[model samples]
Target: MTTWWLMRGDVRVGELRQYGVDQPTFLCHFVSGPGWEAVRELFEAWAAVQGPDPDGSRNAEAIRPLMDLGLTLHPSDGGSPLTCFKGCILRIYGDRARLRY
Candidate 1:
């Protein structure tokens, strides 16, 4: 299974946020499975619109819109699809960490 993280602060600052949910609580919410395909689609669209690597050479700013979209997609759930997917992408791409305010 893929793991996710929630990072605090912005691309300017590399601060990481603690996982807000405990494992049991996180597991409960996450068991339902988030729409990763939708998340990928949104991220690709955002990246295309934002252009490549606005902040760093890695273009962390492109992920900002995905974080915003997560707020809409995952509503009351404490587990964030944006954060999760961002972590996934970072790992997949083997790129630098990306964070958004």
Candidate 2:
């Protein structure tokens, strides 16, 4: 599975799977940092549900935990047959971090 490096500028907060739930080897560091805690919770929720955006289907519940954390998907994904599956939220949060830090 593809992995996305969740970074805060030069620093890597963690890596998340590109699709499906992360494996046992998933890594989450800097728990107290910007994206770490939220990302951890998102991953746990995804793992418990098997995966997010399953079979290219929009998994609303999979991302519910991140709603308050500022996760947003492209509106195209809101309709039947998503534009792309497992769309990353890192960009949104990363930008937020950039502004704050």
Candidate 3:
């Protein structure tokens, strides 16, 4: 299993868990934060685009807010995943911290 922590500075905001190797599925959870509303809107927009076969360009636009928020994706065991969104992966060490996400 591969876990990615979404961090804002020293605080944890969300988590993304990847399961399966051949057909990977991501389980994501996000917490309420200073910019929760904006994040929620972006997430909803992303979901709308994911109705069927999501468009890569539209999906990129949808996740742009998350990137702008400086949310770093930290992987467990200090190793990078094979694939990721926008190629935005920031490796960090340590166990999973407790947070709303």
Query: Model 1 over residues 1-101: C-alpha lDDT tens digits?
Result: 22333233321111122234343232211221234443445445544544445456345555565556433222233465454444333221112223222
- What lDDT score goes with residue 83 in model 2? 16
TM-score of each: 0.26, 0.31, 0.49
Model 2: per-residue Cα lDDT over 7-92, one tens digit each: 44444444433333334332222123355654665645544554445474444666565544543222222333211124433322
RMSD of each: 11.8, 12.0, 7.9
Clashing pairs in 2: none
lDDT for model 2, please. Answer: 0.38
Better structure of 1 and 2 per TM-score: 2
User: Which 10 consecutive positions of candidate 1 have the poorest summed lDDT?
Assistant: 9-18
Steric overlap count per candidate: 1, 0, 0
Please give, for residues 7-74, the per-residue lDDT of candidate 3 as tens digits: 56665655655533332324333334453344455555655664554556776776676567665556
Off by over 4 Å in 1: 1-34, 44-61, 71-101
Off by over 4 Å in 3: 23-38, 50-57, 80-85, 88-101
